[model samples]
Target: MKRLTIAPDERRHIERLVDDVLAEHGHWDPVQFVTQAKTVAESLPLRVRQFFRQIQSEESDVAVLSGLPLSPDLDATPTGWDMAQKTGAGRREEVVLALCSAALGEPFAWGNQQDGRIVHDVCPTPGMERSETSGSSTAPLSLHTEDAFHQCRCDYVALFCLRNPERVGTTVVRADRLDLPAPLSGILAEKRFRHRPDQSHVGPHGHSADVADLDAIMFGPPGSCYLRIDFDDTFAADEDDHAARDAIKELYRHMCDAVERVVLEPGDAIFLDNYRVVHGRDPFEPRYDGKDRWLKRVNLIRDIRRVFLSTGVRSRVIS
Candidate 1:
């Protein structure tokens, strides 16, 4: 468990940087905002920058940064996911999120998600409380690797929390924490796992969507096996792969027993190595009365060029 705290001076530096960027850009443009974030990343504390440079994905699955400055009256959490106002950053916390993510790599959005919005709002909605999207608070979200069905899925998922009054728990299951049985490990390392795209990533008007054709749940080098699983989105490609099915059951039991709950406080952000961790949240009542928990989430890619669908200096959703 690695942690980094923004020093008082560093926090002040951030405030000045954000203010300057907003005054220059005059709007929250993803392209320009990300570039500014990268500059802010360079001015961050040395320890934070060093850790991001050298952290082994499998060894340090998640890193938390704390002691950032928050806007006045934290009670003013956004009510919904709409940014129809089109005004620049509502607060500096989002800039912190993007800056921290830029410290690692390029941040990108999903074309089929949130209408290609790079920064996504994570707040419980009235009708979506039981749904499978991030807005759900009543239904426990099953552990999952972000966008497991996509070939160009994010390498890291960064979440910045601005509000969380209920102290609800966020479930995290890391591959580094799992010591699977040989049989289960062997089965999971094969390429027989089935994955369906998360409902949030599917578009209504588009080419035909199909299940991803994948062979393994934990694929990569032998030592650093990359995890790819979403119990809700994953199924057996061959129902008769009893060995694989049995392995899945056993693995689930092990992971459930070893799950960890992370509760983020004000101005706290966590960056998860998506290839090494599966995360979810426990079921909680969302009052939805403007005080519900809210987090700004973004997906990071180590190498955007490898996954980009078009040529452009600006970032975009993978096609």
Candidate 2:
């Protein structure tokens, strides 16, 4: 009933469109995927189309579309990135996510993450069961803007669910929703914060980008503040780092009071405006018996020129 939901007819139509695309391509190809998905999204039912466009100006940090068809015989949750791309085709849920991503901008992947594969599997990995990365299941992931430490991080991030046996929820916190206290707000506005890149970019298969300090947490057009931060990776350079630790503590306090958790079903996909909000996942038991929760993730930048300008490389990855 809410804007975050999808109607039965809309879902069916989306599936039909996805079928049309797969009939020719038969696989998930990023370049062709966006062109076709855009057309399908534009032709979606008025309600759904309206919701899709809301990513451009919506006050809510996250927009979700549900009820698209999901196959019961979906492949076993992928253990890693290679398996994810190898098995990502023909899923209307992926098409739905691609469509939403195209509406905002071009979908891109980080070379440092998931082996630079276009599609990423967010499943509980065997050894990473307790880490903070997407593969972890036992620990509650802290809030973060995906790739917040990067200068060319995406403008939007979307997660499409293929399985969720545990129904574990993702937590969201909106920067616009909070009325920050004067001191904390002032500190956050200062160019005193330092955020390290997430683990996805720190490992051996990680990016070559330098880990540097962030100038400010909130900055954008007037009346529209975009936030970039990570609870696990960002830290103060020193105790005199503009009360950085205290500033983080204050944000955590606010988040504790105003967090919203959404449990995505099999047919649901949520597109988050990365610049407007931060997201994390709740702790869940990993049933590595091939039925654990799983999701597909992709990042989108509103402008392609930003990517080129940031790294001087015209490729999708900044690292």
Candidate 3:
């Protein structure tokens, strides 16, 4: 896997973007900041465009980028539009929003987490179950795509740490580092694996048991490849797709041994090319005694048309 380190000059550029955003609207209302950031990003320069393109290409395989200034008021979770108005780090949202907007050429929203229900499909546990008791144990999460069931996958998924776990909740990312054998490659190329959405979320309404083409190669771009995987062992496909599914399972099993794990500390933010890498977390005992592990997450869809905004699908703000 190729490593892309953030050069001092590039880091300075990121800092400048953050500073500019905060300086202009740090004191504004959260709603107003969101609106202004959108306006500013729409007219970003060509150099910024090139910078993001470079980031996408170079960091396709490397999953972690360290060394960014931590906001002094970083909290356990991000304050929503309403809550942000009353917090010291309210401006931090604007700063992060601006940085991601410049980096991905698309606007982003704060992931809403209300009463332990996070909006995005984050695994509270490996089993996808919320803690039955206030004192339940946390398991090590396996590497998988953020949302494999969605038709329009986010171009990038980022997690910014507000607090680290007491024990071990190290993030593990696997890329092309795990080599797939010929048999597995042939099975995947044949496109035989099928995946169904976990029944938990789909059961409330009339969601169907839609199965994904698991054998399909996760990445599509020319220069580099990304991955989208479902780590739950219970996710099974049809009999005909069994061989291909087995091949994928075998590859993933190998990945368990080949992962380059990193334990993220406070203020660390990890951005993953959602299309290229599979990420997971090591299990840790969450001491629910007020200091449980907490990280703020954001998902972004890169504008394929940053260089040509009128060509692709128009960006929409998810409410």
Candidate 4:
């Protein structure tokens, strides 16, 4: 849970990196951009290494680097046809990933938004809901992991705020630095509760009845953990596991009480060590007037040895 504020010099370096990548790849050619990005990625210094190491060890760590000096000429939508038809944002994303990979000592893979991609939708939707009568729009979201169901769970999930809600929609993060009560601890440490996969994102393959019974210990190793949480009211455990389920709910409630709420403004990015914290959002009335809170979500799988062609892809654009 330590804070790694970027030193003035280091901040300057990161800005330079961003600018150089933009100028080289953003306006030129895709082939050139990708080639230059790989070249730049190889020369990263030691300070960047230390910075990522700190985050890898303490998943709840945060860094606030201001005065990023973005391109004034850059449009709100950086990857319009002008850019995509020529250079493409795929190369831009790769440049960003390379920067992060240098910082984290892990190869970073992206999620694509193309059709039939292996992207995971971590939010709630209507058809996927268990009951229509819940009728709650702005209820407080509980703390849970992103995709505990996937076998190759994520190592880190980074959310870069392109925009913020006009009203609420605060992000609540539960840090592992806090101690859990005995009853809740026992429940989380036990592999008794079951979780159902969200079918809406799983396509029309019909509901897969595979259930996941997880140990509440939250993580497997000191720094390795997987998140398996869903808000669908239909997902429930059997009668025999009722006590364990109740205990899990109680644990979540208690953790929620101690959460730190952060309202992310534009340009603010939060890197969540998937093993160290649980995150959720507070709902707000969306204006739907083009300004409705839009955030760019990017997930990074840290383990370089495990990268597979079928596992990493982007989420679909919900238009």
> Which candidate number has the best TM-score?
1
| Clashes by residue pair, model 1 | 191-215, 191-216, 192-215
Candidate 1 regions with alpha-carbon error over 4 angstroms: 56-59, 83-89, 205-210, 309-315
Cα RMSD to the true fold for all candidates: 2.4, 2.4, 6.1, 6.6
Model 2: per-residue lDDT, tens digit, 1-319?
Answer: 1246677787777777767767767755765565455566676677776776665765556777777567657777777556666666335556666766676667777777877755567888878878879998889888999888877788878888888988899999887778888888788887777777777788776643445654788777778888988888777666576577789888888977878898999878788889888999999988776677988777888787797787687666655
**Per-residue lDDT of 175-206 in model 1, one digit per residue for the tens?**
87899888788888888887888867666732
Q: Answer with 1 or 2, whichever has the higher TM-score.
A: 1
- Native-to-model Cα distance after best TM-score fit, residue 216 in candidate 4, in Å: 4.0
Q: How displaced is residue 275 in candidate 2, in Å?
A: 1.6
In order of appearance, the predictions have TM-scores of 0.92, 0.90, 0.68, 0.67
Lowest lDDT sum, 10 consecutive residues, model 2, at 205-214
The most accurate candidate by lDDT is 1
Name the weakest run of 10 consecutive residues (lDDT summed) in model 3: 110-119
Q: Which has the higher TM-score value, candidate number 2 or candidate number 3?
A: 2
Clashes of 4: 8
| C-alpha local distance difference test of each model | 0.77, 0.76, 0.50, 0.46
- Candidate 3, which segments miss by more than 4 Å at Cα? 1-52, 76-94, 105-137, 165-170, 198-223, 233-236, 304-319
Ranking by lDDT: 1, 2, 3, 4
- lDDT tens string, model 4, 37-156? 435655544555565667766554444322222333322332222232343323333344445443553333223222222211222223322321111124545455554444444566
